[model samples]
Target: MTEKQFTIVRELDAPRETVWRAWTDPAIAAQWWHPHGLVTPRDSVHVDLREGGSYAYTMVEEATGDSWPTGGTYLEVREPERLRFTWGNPGDAEGEAPVLTVELRELEGGRTEMIFHVLGIDEDRASEQSVFQGWTEAFEELDDALVAAR
Candidate 1:
């Protein structure tokens, strides 16, 4: 059965380059990659930050110590503009992963508009609404990180 796809758009007060780094840099990404109440260890994050490169990270639930590992390879990379990659668990068999695309648009006053798209998600496993909520929380943390960096 085919799965559902989702797209989320967020506008940040930071510049495109800054937003790009937040997504591509392992240190910055680990700071905000998980939903609220989850903590990602900096040592568990790895990002190559280049086309054809791969990234892996683990997010642990704060109270339960449950760990969720996600890793994927970069399919396309356009610095400060867009990034396309596979999104899946590290143990998934080859060719069984979905795709995630992130597009960044530069706005006036160094603002950035980011579009996050995920394709081939199993709606039954994770409903669109739930995924949206997770991403929303993650982005909120990302916003805070960006602000703190400035």
Candidate 2:
């Protein structure tokens, strides 16, 4: 089977460092780590931000109380610039998981351009409630978190 990938490039109204913290700091990540209608409680977030380290979080659907647990190991970590990691169920084999890379570029006026890429999943799995849509909504949540932080 051919592996597929998707990339989301966003211009965020925050600095690269801020964006990096938002991803690496569990406290900050818990604010926006989930898609719309889902909540990632701060207690459910764990981040060990370093090469070979791992991170995990659980997103809960408020209405149904359904929880989705996700985690991954860091393949590469370059603070405020780039991060590459596996993304899948906690404790899953890294080799079998999809890889996600996030590149952050500092833009003019204290803003950032973030390039997010995910590899391994096919298009059919990238449906409305899946990877693509989930991240799209999560990013929107991140934007709100950023604004509130300012």
Candidate 3:
């Protein structure tokens, strides 16, 4: 089967180190891990931050109390540069889960260019749930979190 993937590129107003922490630190991640209507409680995020380590987070919809538990293993971890991991439910087999890769490049003036790519989701499903839209909104939230940390 053909693998379906999507990539999002954004320039963030923060240093590469700060952007890296936002992705790997549970406390920072909780601030913007979910879509606009959902919330990721700080206590619900776990990050091991190692090549073979696993991480998980739960995004809860406050209005309905619905939660989505996502967990994945780190396939590659290079501090302040790149990360590749599987994206799926807790205990999912790596082979069957989607893969996500994040690449960070330091720019002039303490800025960062982030490239986020994901594979294994079909185009139809991605569109039906507005996955791209959700991530875009989440990135906006991440921007706010980065600014607040400054």
Say which candidate scores most in lDDT: 2
Candidate 2 residue-wise lDDT, 54-106, digit = tens: 89999999999999899999999998899999998887777889999999999
Give the alpha carbon lDDT tens digit for every residue of 64-104 in model 1. 99999989999999987999998879889647788889999
Clashing pairs in 1: none
Model 1, C-alpha of 105: deviation from truth (Å): 0.4
How many clashing pairs does model 1 include?
0
Query: How do all models score by TM-score?
Result: 0.90, 0.94, 0.92
Per-residue lDDT of 145 in model 1: 81
How does candidate 1 score on lDDT? Answer: 0.87
Query: Worst 10-residue stretch by lDDT in candidate 3?
Result: 121-130
lDDT, model 2, position 5: 89
| TM-score (C-alpha) between model 1 and the true structure | 0.90
lDDT digits (tens) for residues 1-150 of candidate 3:
666888899999999999999999898999999888899999999998899999999999999999999989999999989999998788777799989899999999999999999898653434535767778889999999999777
The global C-alpha lDDT for each of the candidates, from Candidate 1 onward, is 0.87, 0.91, 0.90
Query: What ranking emerges by TM-score with the best candidate at the front?
Result: 2, 3, 1
Give me the displacement of residue 120 in model 2, in angstroms: 0.7
In candidate 2, stretches whose alpha carbon ends up further than 4 angstroms from where it belongs are 123-126
